[model samples]
Target: MLTRKQMELLDFIRTRMGTDGVPPSFDEMKDALDLKSKSGIHRLITALEERGFIRRLAHRARAIEIVKLPEAMESGGFRPRLVAEAAPPPPPPRGALAIEPVHALELPVMGRIAAGVPIEAIAHVSHHVAVPGSMLSGKGQHYALEVKGDSMIEAGINDGDIVVIREQTTAENGDIVVALVEDSEATLKRFRRKGNMIALEAANPAYETRLLPDHAVKVQGRLVGLIRTY
Candidate 1:
């Protein structure tokens, strides 16, 4: 039998994966369960894994596979989604030099970025995701963020899409960027400047453009490329 916290965590993970095609980050789980620290989450995950409830992928950040559901969840007709394992490539021809695959690099997924209302600034690395090197722009450093809202839908950015960001402290007008608001909250929006004011514009008509003092906005990074999983 699973503990109450364990069941809650499992249900949360399954629900997030079903919605976003990715599991929630440790911080998110911590917040959802109202736990004081991530250590509690770690222990609960270990317990679930020991019970054959989930599998954590080695060397992958935040990668988890749901192995089975409890009887209660099963009666609800929940179907676990299985991630197919990639088969090993055939051995190179005898005497042929083996070449490593190119153009793919592992980038840290910092955390979720809000595309609608601004959320707390994400400063820690949650996990790493493999991104095509070509997706990176002329960058000093690059990172990935899971988008969390639909305000940028008109720009072709959707909730659950992974956005590749080139770290920078500046942006041109109309460029979509990760904007840190008041040094506390972060959002994904188009950047616009007028006089000494900065405008964070949302693509969707439902969201009004937020105009703030230039000093209140900081450009964390600019959007480079996006990846979406069906």
Candidate 2:
């Protein structure tokens, strides 16, 4: 059995980790739990750890792993459920009206991009999205991808959000870029080069950073804009 506060903490951790690929920071937990200080958050974490609910990852700041779920919560339907029924997407405008002149550039809608784990890139044009030309500031052809996971949620890129990417083969440090690994898999993460290794880092605490040989990772594009539908 878990105390109400403990249950709340556990649920928060689970939801955050599930959606962000990392555990919530102490400040985030404090704010969410309405605690006065980090000490109170520490106490709650310690209690949960002592009961085998979560484990802290050594050498990683703000890192935590859910070891097990509370039996009662799982079996008693205590977890919150997501609403699956979304309103149908508004139909795309067919023709321009003289009253409301819209100037936009249509970009290919790439299949999908894994925001969590690296997945094979589905290289097919599904459709096209009309975006304001002002939003495409970078050079090279721009494409849009449907983000499929929450690994980049902490960076404000949520699952199902369409990200406009500027196609490029190079990126600066700390740029959130689409990276292809071994020519077979792709993921969206912050790009960094340390000595000879390339690291693709997630903004969330739940996912570990991926490191590879410098020649193994290819930069697909840099994220330049985003469009969230509802």
Candidate 3:
């Protein structure tokens, strides 16, 4: 028998693929189960794959295929545990402004970006978040990254916040940007040009500034906004 968590994950994958014709991403699975880490989602997925409940296609992103679903879900009796165990949200009062349906723009949430030490960039799109077009500013393509450190806490960007970034190769001074250093590592910092050097400045005093020649730094994107899940 599948554990409750495994059952929950399997149900989610089936439901999502049935709706969207694509398997949900790791981050989506994590959010669906109220999981604290993607590692937990990975473990659960591996268990399902091992049990013949799902198949992961090789050389693909979000390429999971559901082979079997729990009887509970198949019978239409399985409400997601995260939803079933939680209290229902109160209904909006009558005559409250009707919510207008707005189209959402889905952006890839790439792997985590460091706010301190630069980390090797992961090119795969792990998950995505849908934000209304109004939430974004420019016409440039955008992507999202999860902040992993408190190096920018002084600037109100905290660990665990998902930052929406506008793709660009150049940034103005004082703009918070995702910078690719030496074409290998990526970091989130304030962009600065001082004399002949390009500086990636941390918002918090605890971290020292990194200075390199202008050619060594590539501006990946500028901060657009952020999504923080409660």
Say which candidate scores most in lDDT: 1
Could you tell me every candidate's TM-score relative to the true structure? 0.58, 0.56, 0.58
| Worst lDDT 10-window in candidate 3 | 77-86
Q: State how far residue 117 of model 1 sits from its true place (Å).
A: 0.5
lDDT (0 to 1) per candidate: 0.84, 0.80, 0.80
RMSD of each: 13.8, 18.4, 12.9
- CA lDDT of 96 in candidate 2? 45
- Give every collision pair in model 3: none
Error of 3 at 156 (Å): 1.1
Candidate 3, residue 40: how far the Cα is off, in Å: 40
Q: Candidate 2 on 7-53: residue-level lDDT in tens?
A: 66888988899899988999999998776899979988998898899
On residues 56-115, what C-alpha lDDT tens digit does candidate 3 reach at each position? 999988888888765545655323111122344466689886555464677767668999
Q: Which prediction has more favorable lDDT, 1 or 2?
A: 1
Q: Which has the higher lDDT value, candidate number 1 or candidate number 3?
A: 1
Please give the ranking of all candidate structures by lDDT, highest first, separated by commas: 1, 2, 3
User: What does candidate 1's lDDT look like per residue over 17-61, in tens digits?
Assistant: 999999999999999877789998998899899989999999999
Residue 53 of model 3 has an lDDT of 88
After superposing candidate 3, which stretches have Cα over 4 Å from the reference? 1-96
